[model samples]
Target: MSEKKGSLSINSENIFPIIKKWLYSDHDIFFRELVSNGCDAITKLKKLEMMGEAEIADDEEFKIQILANPKEKTLTFIDNGLGMTADEVDEYINQIAFSGAEAFLEQYKDKTSEDQIIGHFGLGFYSAFMVADRVTIETLSYKKDAKAVLWDCEDGMDFTMSDSDKADRGTKITLYLNDDSVEFANIFKAKEILDKYCSFMPVEIFVSDPSAEPEYQTIMEEELTDKDTVIEHIVEPAKTEEKEKEDGTKETVEVEPEKKKVKILKRPVSISDTTPLWTKHPNECTEEEYREFYHKVFLDYKEPLFWIHLNMDYPFNLKGILYFPKINTEYESIEGTIKLYNNQVFIADNIKEVIPEFLMLLKGVIDCPDLPLNVSRSALQNDGFVKKISDYITKKVADKLSGMCKTDKEEYEKYWDDISPFIKFGCLKDTKFCEKMSDYVLFKNLDDKYLTFKECLEENKDKHENTIFYTNDPVQQSQYVNMFKAEGIDAVVLKDAIDQPFISQLEQKNENVKFVRIDADLNDSFTEEISEDELKDATEKLTETFKKALNRDQLDVKVQKIKDEKVSSMITVSEESRRMQDMMKMYGMSGMDPAMFGGSGETLVLNANNALVKYILANPEGENTDIMCKQLYDLAVISHTPLNPESMTAFIERSNKILEILSEK
Candidate 1:
């Protein structure tokens, strides 16, 4: 081929600047595009070799080599894959948007699928222009006696092509780093970019710095592989140590034998794990492997609760591992990373289009070669196909949870406290998931036992009918909890923030079922059944006496007779009103007074059997009567909720006066 120069096939000169600045979402994505192109090249070469169209040695290892030269202000990417001839370069490189991978797939359509190729648009090669002022490519095709070609472009619009003296059967791309992009020429920065985008690329990748002095490391021969380069061998002499005999005499003993070590050039480890754990079948993976992969990808030291391995090929090719991380606390953010990939090249993290919105609380990877990615591959093209993928993922997670509950209830319950928030969130977000996981939702009861909603309702059916009482804070509601326990009632614990909305959704789903807090109401079993007339008379007298003594005539008071003689008074908040107030607080409307909606929705219930109530009722005008009434009201208020500053101070002073009266007596 003769030396030639021509203008690029781009329509306008402004396209180069647009491609450099706005084509990709991030400036660092150029590494991903260029490295993935190399992966495609190697994959195509392997396919040809398998079909006997090209010859490749069995011992040959195909990889991508990245060399950063800070001194020279240049970065180079080398790949031992199917290189291009001069005509091929002119056709693919000279012509913008003409994808070489697409052309090869078209040529070999009958033999292979597009899954093996990572690059679809020819603009990937031009991504180098994003970080470089000038770019050059030297290559020799895999064909026998193929003439090497050298292609260079300064403005990315015009190019010069000529024959080259390059001897390798692959392509090498060199980028002259721009002043703003000089950081890419540093070895550490280059490696960081490779780790971000190419951690699981299909082809092995290695980063290097030619300007630094070569370092050497010693490795045992048993630990060496074909990838390691041996510099020299060393044999350490055996060591002797003094040992004490039974008679307390010291003796010499050989404690260690000679060891052999191989010194080799310390090369950077391969930045890519070609076969990630997600690609393997579930049956082929072990428990430890999933945990290790979770730690490696997410850098989370805490182990995951469990994982679901997704492997599908029938409808569309997809492989991944979805890990339900063990939440350490309720305050910890539930947002998790679900890395989206095409083939093995990472595209983005937490892509809600392919992963269900609820599944964003899980940490894992999903590689779907069939994803409908746009030209730059930075975002997904919203379509029905993407919806189907999201729905598929949601279904898989639901299936895993429901299956675990059915087969291994003990283990599922063990992970419930750590994983319940995720399950409840999932149920609230996805209807299909809710339908599948409804029966699997486990609630921790006050007895520290796990029970499903049906079990809870069934166990308390005769006592509370269809209502299942729960406690938000068992400590603050300990009096109510103990009262329920004394009455042989069961209350589940719903302490998580998501539990509020979750139970609301559950109520909508099950019309007959209701979730009431333990402190929301007083049970009938705690009160004696008195005649209507007598109860009305006692309620009227007690209500007037307490209201007058406390100086609050609008207070709602109820009188219950002869129920636990030691119990004096308690407060109850209406469940509906409490829920409304909570909703208001959640929406930042807590500043509004509760009386604006309805008069506090609180009722002070006084036990007629207690001596305090009896004394207050007998001597309504007595000096100590007001003190006892106010003390009882304050006690009830403190038990139910915190007392206001003024009310608390008054209550304390009144208690002290009563103690002084007792001392004087």
Candidate 2:
């Protein structure tokens, strides 16, 4: 190799400093950049071979080898790819922001099919300065007349070029670590970086460490234990060892000796599956293969319920696999791992704005070659294309859900409870998604069956018209659920916290449909109206007694003839007011208890048909009447919510005293 000195064609000397200081948020990204360059180099060579410009052996394997030396504090990426000659190195290495891949693609567009040539800005090589004091590249071009070249650059645009006899037709990049970034030179750290960024790369990557022990592979072979010992029997199952039968009749073969097996160990480490499941045809992939790939990627032991394999080339080139993980609880830690990739190079997992907020609750991998990336390939650039990608992801998820609900409803119903929270969250956040999912939205009724919004209305039309009664807490509202079930009214279960806002969205979507909580208002409370004389004679006295007994002016008590004579009374709270109280509780609004919303306690309904109300009405003012009214009010409060410690103790003592009197009789 001949040697020379030169400067990279950057306008200013501050470019390298800018790249090191502000381009990348994390220093470890420098390793990813360099490895990506190595992959690009290999991809370029393959393209050249495809164009018939160079000869490739039939069995030539394409791979990248990572070599690290802790003593030297150097990390090297060696690839058997297309290399560069002296002039080529001088032009590309001594240039800034000049893309060689772009030029090569332009030159060969008419001759060869396209490949995923990653380096578009050509500044990926300079990222080494972020962690290294110096960088060197040794390359030999695929050109027959090209000479091997050596290029060296310090922490600036100034670099040195030389000629050498590197026989390999590829490039080797070695970075000499700086004092501040020596951690990268560690063997384990280097391997970890490779695994994160290059594990699913299109090229096989092998890490070489001289200090590492040999890795082994175990192989088992069956063999005969002893031929002459008159053992039970052994046969070569691989190549059927048969014995002749003395009898004339056709007979099956018999084994000659007992069988034994030997184990053999072999060692070779290539730490990548270059061809991942996402890169293959959806029809070619089996369910097992998809699950195994998902297990390998996320390390989540729980099997995914279903997956959406997105392979689209039309509007943009996007390939990904989105898995609907088994989310057991609504409040379970929902940290979705969506690994984003640019040309199969790891970008970042937390690209929130690019991925819809709802889809952020899923685990998956997305590789978009055409995604506009910053210099570090970590931050995504804002553009219409990015917005399109986000919308497309939302569309794909909606489509998958729609397909599931239509094709396999029995199986889909099983996942509705687990997946409904995510869908409801999406609807609350995205209007388009809400519109798309309206038909596919499945609501479970009291009969343990699922139905659509229209179906719910149609099925319950005779009992409740245009009104959808739902329960937030199945346990707390089970009493009301039973009451409604007796009247042939099926209430949908809206158990998730997100359902707080989702009901409003559903109502707005269908103005004719009105959603009501089962505990919101009793049906009989509005069914009957009292005459003027009845209010003066019995209802007014009843209301006054309830007000006096509860000892709270905020309690608004109403008299109604409830349907169930077995019930003493029931409590009903306004749905709008309750939702407001729930929202205030979430924010921890100062000095606000959910029990006392809008400076008022729960609305107490006095059942006119109950026997206890008639006795309380007969003696509305006496101390015994007061005690009975207090107990009745307390019982209603207990059913609706928990009573205070003091109130509960008093109630228990009074109940025991009454029980002791009943035992005396």
Candidate 3:
């Protein structure tokens, strides 16, 4: 144990052990803390020069060098940056909560990194005690006639500082590795740690070389004249044939030869890339550069479908690159792979909170210094800055998509299939994002051409009375689509599962704009001049017959008459009811409540001009009337519009039996 000196306190003895044992998981982080302290020293020197307190040295190269030796089981960190005086070291190291780095930074706030201080807390320097059994620091201050000081600490809170006859402009920390932490003294392991955690540091970091050279050369063996190399070759003799046995059988045998073996040469592996693409500016980065970075980070051979570069300063500082990977299948294999990085060091496996839920489909690097990192750099705390960064990233993505849509429609549509899910999810979950995304989102028409909501509405304004008609299931509702086509009104295909709720919310936000299903009656005019009394009368009479024909006990039905004359008897469900069913399904509720289903019943409109419905109304006992009624009702049910499947099947069977009787005649 070493003796405690001036300003040494007993409080550190109790807390320092707890910090070493529980504060961090890896003992190697001590190197990072020590290196950070070295950078802080360099920053302090630069600050003094900027403040006119010291003369600035020309051609000074600021760097931190790390040395490790496996044979000796020792590691050393040296910096040509700055040094500390005896009094400064006592105040910073001997006393807890008195941070020399923080004080230096505050005193030189006017200087930048080239002339500004770096570190804020002195606790980082003490981290060396976690891995080293004995740690020593030799430093020489920049002040004129300053004496060199040496500080030594063993496995306790006590430390000793004394005058040294060393000549240096900065500090050097030598650590004697403990038996359990011998790996830290390995050159290869130390290099890996520095590359992963300190690759993009402001100051250049140097570590021992861990690679060896391979060469091919001619062989020499005593000029081929040694006694062991005598020029005499021996040959094996031939074997004789076997003799006949007493059983009157002759046999011959041969010996097996030994196999020859070939040797293969092994190559060395290098794990670090000094330059990562994210550190470069967006303009300087080519598409190939981005792709290479993606492959390096994710190890995926396939190229990204699209990318968004994020660079923002205020409201908050944030920087990153997000990529949308191609989703070739429905297996959801490419979700939640986006990595979160702080100062180029990986912080988390998946950045769910930093990026919107919708953007989880993207895979790339998000490096934000503003993000709060725990000691291990494994998790991030949720704070105001994190939220601000998330919002900024979302905006950047939206801006990229919108810009692509405006510049090149064809290219935008090509990538839309891959990015649509992310966009839809963003709109559904984030209200602010939804408002910004509405203008750029697109819909695919029956012809497979992409159309924006505003564009579709504008083109069909005169024909549809400003109503946007769409269908959820195109295959099941082919009849409705044909009806809309015959009336010359274009309807969008809302095939995505999220479309129903998204549109419902969109309708509520906008006025005079309606999203009607294709199966909805076209004649239910959006135009003026149809009296309310006339609509009420038509609805009452039709509702009465529809109830009787469709069997109101098992099915709920309503009727409404509209203006356009294309076809008859179309079934349409209310947007509210559809939204509720979707919500119930999302929550995994198999048994739904009747009251919660909403009172919006399905409306079945009959075209008064259609010959089948006209014949049924004129002669309620007509033979073909029942068959036509059952077929129409079944069609409505299959179209996902609403009809009782059981009652419709029974009506169909009875109609079939009646047809059989007519055939017998």
Q: Put down candidate 2 lDDT per residue, 451-526, tens digits, no spaces.
A: 8989988876886789888887777766677788777777888877777778887788788888888888887533
lDDT per residue for candidate 1 within 78-102, as digits (tens), equals: 9999999988998888877664534
Task: Give TM-scores for every candidate, taking all chains together and pairing residue i with residue i.
Answer: 0.89, 0.84, 0.62
> Which portions of model 3 miss their true places by more than 4 Å?
1-13, 17-89, 100-120, 126-156, 160-196, 202-274, 310-319, 333-399, 423-438, 476-479, 497-501, 519-553, 557-572, 597-665
lDDT of 2 at 562: 68
TM-score of 1: 0.89
RMSD vs true structure, all candidates: 5.5, 7.9, 11.3
Tens-digit lDDT string for candidate 3 (489-581): 788888666677678777777777888777654453322244577656545655555556655754444433333443456666565565565
Please identify model 2 stretches exceeding 4 Å from their true place. 99-120, 211-266, 350-354, 525-532, 535-539, 593-601, 621-627, 644-661
TM-score, model 3 to reference? 0.62
Candidate 1 ranges beyond 4 A from true positions: 99-120, 220-262, 530-554, 598-600, 625-627, 642-665
Give the range where candidate 1 is weakest over 10 consecutive residues by summed lDDT. Answer: 109-118
lDDT of each: 0.85, 0.77, 0.67
Question: Residue 30, candidate 3: how far off, in angstroms?
Answer: 5.0
